[model samples]
Target: RFPRNVQLCVLSFLLPSDLAAFASTCKRLVSLCRRDQRLWFSMCHRRWGSQTLINKWGSGRISYRRLYRILDEYKNLIGFWRRCGDSAAPASSSPPPVFFEWGPSYIAGSRVFPSKNKGYDAMIEKPFLWMSVAWNRKAMNYLDSDGKFVLNEEDLIGESGFVENELIRVNVGKNKITYN
Candidate 1:
């Protein structure tokens, strides 16, 4: 077996999925590569170029491995959401009215306003990098940066008026497509 430094240097070039698979190969490698603080820090830095955000998320004694797992899991979920349907066609037979909130960069909700386009064309115009797009027949929900579905919550103990989503739209387009 190579030294710890060599293993870390090699693992730095691997994607998170590849590194996960490598760890499964043996127990010793798992203990070595998975827990290497420097290796995980490097991976996180390479994946996201913001050290301040990383430090904040990694606060409260959270290890770099755990932070990486959280970010990787979110990315995997988005990938799965994207691959669930064909993008060539519209995500649904009819586009549902989408909500775009311009606020402190942490709110998710859909609002119905008059559109300039005729006949009420439905599309999600701009999606922040930290948000996820999901939809059901009744509504399209954009999850927050923490991967939680954003919605207004009324005071409990009475009939809460929030509706749970029945299905997630698989073919939501990231941006509008204008054919020539």
Candidate 2:
């Protein structure tokens, strides 16, 4: 095994999934990855893109792992919602509670195709974090890097608002999403 610095440099090239798999193979690798915030930061910058971190996270002292996890959660949740359908529509002409199965979702180029995933139900059980939206109308897209969220205009606006490039910030906790 190389020194910690060399280990970190080597580990930096691994994707999050690859890193996790490598870390699981031994305690030394796990400790090296977890204890060094710089490694995680490098991973964050690599996966999410640098400007994305600057725009969304700024220079604040935030955990890279936490940021990555929350972003993953958002992607999963949006995928679930998109698959479930018509978020603006009422649950059944009545309101009490509504629930549905999970779905698959993906972004290809600038477009997002909605589908189903059974794992969505699991997302609801996780704690709420925070979300940020970068609304780009000319490009017709909505983005949240931390939550791994991206929605095209049709999914979010449904042909109504004057689409413009703007950033919307919201905090999701205490069972609510509040603008900041």
- For all predicted structures, in order, the TM-scores are 0.39, 0.40
Candidate maximizing TM-score: 2
- TM-score, cand. 2 vs. native: 0.40
| lDDT for position 89 in model 2 | 61
The local distance difference test score of each candidate is 0.46, 0.44
lDDT tens digits, residues 1-180, model 1? 788788788898888789889999999878767778889877866775342245434222467777666556434322212224455656664333444332221122342334566556743333322222111111122222233343433311111122324213322334431211
lDDT of 2 by residue, 41-112 (tens): 666667555334422342233466665554454444432222244567676543222222111111221222
Which numbered prediction scores highest in lDDT against the true structure?
1
Candidate 1 vs. true structure, TM-score: 0.39
Q: Give the range of the ten consecutive residues with the poorest summed lDDT in model 2.
A: 101-110
- The true-structure Cα RMSD of candidate 1 reads 11.7
